[model samples]
Target chain A: MFRAYSALIRKEFIQVSRDRNMLRLIFLMPVVQLLVLGYAVNLDVKKISLDVYDFNRSQTSRELVDAMKAGDYFIPGEEGQTKERRPLWHLADRFQDGSAQMAVIIPEDFSERLTRGENVTIGLMADGTDANSARIGLGYTAQIVDRYAWKHTGLSPPIGIRSAFLYNPETESVYYMVPGIVATLLTMVTIMLTSMAIVREREMGTLEQLMVTPISGFVLLMGKITTFAILGLLEMVIALAVGVLWFGIPFVGSPLLLLALAVLFLISTLGMGMFFSTITSSQQQAMFLAFFSTIFAMLTSGFFTPISNMPQWMQYITYLNPMRYFMTIMRGILMKGAGIADLAPDIIALAVYGSVIFSLSVIRFKKRTE
Target chain B: MNDKIVVQVENLTKRFGTFTAVNNVSLSVRQGEIFGFLGANGAGKTTVIRMLCGLLLPSSGMGKVAGYDILTQPERIKRAIGYMSQKFSLYPDMTGRENLYFYGAAYGLGRKLIGERVMALSERLSLREFLDRPSKGLPIGWRQRLALAVSTLHHPKILFLDEPTGGVDPAFRRTFWSTLYDLAEEGATIFVTTHYMDEAEYCRRISIMHQGQIIELGTPHELVKKHRAANLEDMFVDLIRKRESDNA
Candidate 1:
């Protein structure tokens, strides 16, 4: 059995190495995707245009505008880039033309309210077209206003927020995105390759030849999926190396634990690939199914959007997606250095899902071959 | 070769949906005999070979290959026979040597044993020159030789060649036939399917199938005389034509 398994893996590697396109796709795809998506999938909203409308023209209001400009998150809008004295009513137009993402209006009594020790109001309008930036811009606005009020009034708030972000202090989106991409790349490569493995043989009619041999269905499946599983792990390593070396993303957890869980993750994906192979006779069909499922898994996995932000029903549906648990596990391990105890639920869920999917696919594959 | 039977099937039948592919087919092939399975396209020739090779299950039938039941002992049957499919089934991206070694190991042969077999088969089949290059770019004749070597690598007693020389030139086909003769001489039972009637004439016995049933079974000269046809091709055409007319 070992001899047959080893030979099958060696043959797969030879075939993979011989095909230049597959070689490039296998080794280069993750690196290229990491470079592109690590930089492009940035959710960190910066350079938000804040059009300041100071009705008071007071020193306090000017200081407030300057405070908003202290960080890279906000850039004060020029007086009138498009038109001179752009009307405040044209706020909608400014947002429509993509000139300003947010506008702040300070009331006339802004300084008087502070001297009198009374509460003052400032109006901040944000374009909700890009909801993520809009929401973040609003949050920055609240922080700046609260600080300004406390500084000017000489009276501190009864309760102050000294919250510090855990795992990621500056909340760099790349730090979060790199690990997610690693998980996604592993899933994509393994599922696509394994899904195509058996189907390609069947399409080329090599499967019929293999079936006539003394090799059992179990050996064939093990040999094929083992090759892909190793390939998937190699892709993960490449993505991780790029993540840690190029992106300088810190790996906070036990590397051994991450590697162990990655194997667990591969079981589910490889099983899914095998299931697809049994159902589809053609490689193209298997590839389409794999692609569609990967996309579905990615979308629901909270890789792009947080599952909590999804509709309640969609959030419930995400529980069925193994990638969702893997995603959380990846981010937890890589960012927070989370141990298994902290990740027991997710790890347990993955184990259950992996075994069930792997066994089901294996059973179906054996039946199909027999 | 002794007179022991290697392949025997009785009332062999396979059905897909409502169509009966192999309709109660029955035939037996003896050790060292060259058995020709002849039919037009879609006459269920490939289906029958698929069943015999254990690639597909017979919907209803009883058969044995090398003393192993096709139904109850398919794994043993697989171990005891060799199958070269009609399609060039070896991995195209792999070199001929790699293909041979892979199949050799798949049959549980060790590394030294596979290497020895590869060396011997490459020499025997004149495949040494093309053994190092990928099989995809090799000429069809060379690829067929490589596939034949792979099928025979484990040295099974029974070999099933499905149109083993389908698109080969006459010279290559002659050489291929000589190889078959050598295998038969070495006590390997050959069950072959072919489109070329000349190749059919080379068979020790032939079964002519039409519409999923064997209408004639005998040696080439006996079949030609029994059907009163000029040659095997003419006899094959007359039999298929008569069957079509009867159906009409």
Candidate 2:
């Protein structure tokens, strides 16, 4: 069985090595995506253009106006000095049209309310059509204004915000995004290529030729898993290097722990793929299922948002996702410098998924006479 | 006589829920004989081969392939049999040598055995020069011959060829027949299916399956004599017409 499985694995490696494009995709595409996403895709919104609709020309309103421009998040732009009372709507359109992203509306009563020492709530109209961008912009605006008011007013605030952000310290998008993208990339390409190899054989009518041989399901699955695990590992290494050196994200975990976790992740991922292949009759079905499995992995896998932020029920559902634990292991190692002792639960979860899926795939493949 | 029976099927049936593929049927293939299975498309020749190869479970009844119980020794039968499909199954990107190597390895032959057998098979298949070139670039004739060589690499006792010579030139088809005879001479049971009537003439005995039931089974001459037909194709037409007439 071992000899048969090793032979099968070797055959898979030969097939993968011959295709230069697959090799390039397994390594290069992940690295490029990791770098581009790390540098460009940020949770903190910067350079948000704000159109000022300042009807209050008093010194207090001017101070509010000055507060908006004090941070990198809010860049003060065209001030509409119009007699029209409804200039705020027109300014909202400009924000929608990309001239600005956020519109700051200063009420005409702003100067009088501040002199009376009453707290003035400044209206911030953000286009929440794209909610993520809008939320980031809104948070930045609130933070900057609070700081400016306390600094300029000579009012020593009684309380300060003591915020403890969880997971990522630098709030670097790379630290969070790299793990998810790696999972997605490996799941996408490794499955497509591995599953497609069988599909093509069936199309070519060569699968029957292989099936008739002494090779059993155990041998075939082992070959597929080993070959894909190597490719998945290779891709992870390349993506990790780019994440570490190019993006300057720290990789502070033990290499042995990372390697061990990756094996469990690849097994569960490839095992699911082989199960899909067994059910799928054609390349189209394989491709469709591969796409379906990974999108849910990306959206629900807690790579972008806090899984804790999800409802309690959704958090329970995500436990079934092998990708969720893989992302946990990846982020734990890559970002927080977590060790094996800290990640024992995640390791056990991945092991369960792998053992179940691998066993199911092997058991599912019936010998023709049976 | 019992030793002569390489495969024995008794009232074998295959059904998918409500649909019946291979109806209750019994058949046997003799050792060291060219058994021809002839039928129109969708007549379940492929289905029977799959069942014999342990690809699908029979709905009812039982069978034995190569002296092993179908249910108990399926893995053994799988290891013991060779199958050449109608469709060209060779990988397009791998050279003839590479494909042969992969298939050989898949059969669980180690490095030394694979090397020796590939060398021997390549020379016999006359693919020595082109083994380094991908199978896709080879002509249809060489491709079919190469596929046959790969299928029989393990020297299985019973070889099933499902329309193995669809696209080969007539000359290679003749050469293919000669190779089948050579393998048969070595006491290998060759069970082949084809739409071609002339190929049926080369078989020691033949069976025609229609809608999953074996309608006619005999030596080629005996079948012609029984139907009082000029040739196998006309005999098949006569049988089909008789069945239609009987159904009506």
Candidate 3:
């Protein structure tokens, strides 16, 4: 059985090597995607265009406007060009025209109230279309205003919240997204490669020839999975190297443990590929099936948003998604330096999902031969 | 001649839902004989071959290949036979030599033996010049011959060929048949299905199947004589017409 399996794997390698362009693309894709998508997914809002309308033109209002522009988060928009100030209502039009993401208006008595030691309010408006950036930008603007008040009055607020970020203190999106990219890239490459390999054989009728051989279905499945599993691991290594070397994402945990979890993750992916091949009669069907399922898996895997934020039913559905657990394991190990003990539940979930899916696909593949 | 029966089928039947693709077919093939199966398209020749090769399960009845029950021990039967489908079923992306090595190893042949057989078979089939090229780049005739070489690399006791010369030129078809004769002479039973009536003449015995039934079975000469036809082609036509007229 092992002899036959090795022969099948060798044949796969020879066939893949013959397609020189494919060989190059497989290795190059992960690195390119990691760099390009890592920068693209950044959530740290910066250089937001700000439109300011100061009706008072007081020293305190000018001071407030200067304070907002002091940091990188907010920059003055076209409002700086006009000598005549626009009314507060026109701020809405400026936002609608994409001129600014935020607008700040100081009332006519804003400095008088500050000088008389009475409470005063500044009006702030923001476009709420993109909820994430809008919320973060609002928080930054409020913080800047509060700091300005403290500087002018020489009094701190009653409540001081000094929040510190843990794990990723700088809040670099790449630190979070690189690991997810590694997981997503591995899933794409492994599933697509394995399914295409099997479907190509079926389309060419070589699978029918193989069915007549002494090689059992279990042996054939093992041959295919093992070959693609190795390729998947190599892909992970390439992506991880880019994450660490190029993107500067930290890899603080045990490399051996990460590889073991990766193997388990790849078992699930390769199993899904095998299962797809069993149901699809042609390469085209296999490709569509693999592609749609990969996209679905990525969406529900908590790679982009928190699983807790999803609806209860969606959260339950994610329990069956192997990628969710893989994403957790990857983030835990890579970002937090988590050990096996810290990731026991995730590891168990992955092992269960991997074994069940792998075994089911093997059974289906055997049945398909008949 | 060896008296050992390599394949024996009794009342074998296969049904897809309500349609009976192969129904109550019974035949026996002896070692060292080229037994031809003749039928028109959709006549269930491929279905029977698939069942006998252990690639399909018989819906009912009993069959044995190489002394193993087809129902109980398909893996064992698979080990004992070689099969080449009507379609050339070798990997097109790999070279012919690579395909030979892969199949030989798939049958559990050792490295040294596979190497030796690859060399010998490539020489026998005159495939050495095309061995390094991908199978897809080879001419159709060469691809078919290479497929034959790959299927026979492990030298199984029985071989199943399903219309192996479907589109070959007459000269190439003759060469292919001569190779089968050589294999038969070496004590291998060859079970083949073809639409070509002239190819049926090369078989030691021929079976004609129609609409899921084997309506006629005999030596080519005997079948021609019994039907009072000018040739095997006429005998085939006469047999089908007789079945149709009987139904009418």
Best candidate, TM-score-wise? 1
Question: Candidate 1: where is the Cα deviation over 4 Å?
Answer: A44-163, A367-370
Cα lDDT of model 3 by residue, A122-216, tens digit = 76666543333455766887798778878888765321223223345455677778888899988888888888889988788899899888888
Lowest-sum lDDT 10-residue window in model 3 chain A:
A157-166
lDDT score at residue A349, model 1, on the 0-100 scale: 92
Query: What lDDT, from 0 to 1, does candidate 3 have?
Result: 0.84
Give RMSD to native, each candidate. Answer: 9.7, 10.0, 9.9
Q: List the residue pairs that clash in candidate 1.
A: none
Runs of candidate 3 with Cα error greater than 4 angstroms are A42-163, A367-370, B245-248
What tens-digit string does per-residue lDDT give for candidate 1 at A82-188?
34555678776676545777787776777787677776667777764344556677778778768876787657632122322323555566776787788888888
Residue-wise lDDT of candidate 1 within B119-199, one digit each (tens)? 988888988899999889999999999999999999999999999999999999999999999999999999999999999
**What is the fnat value (0 to 1) for candidate 2?**
0.75
lDDT for each residue of candidate 2 in A196-300, tens digit (9 for 90 to 100): 776666676766666777777677767777788888888888877777787676677787788888887888888888887778889899888888888777767
Error of 2 at B35 (Å): 0.8
Candidate DockQ scores, in order? 0.62, 0.48, 0.58
Clashes of 1: 0
DockQ agreement of candidate 2 with the native complex: 0.48
Ranking of all candidate structures by their DockQ, best first: 1, 3, 2
Least well predicted 10-residue stretch by lDDT in candidate 2 chain A: A158-167
lDDT tens per residue, model 2, B119-233: 8887777778888887888999888888888888777899999998987778989989998998898899999999888999999999998878998899999999998999888
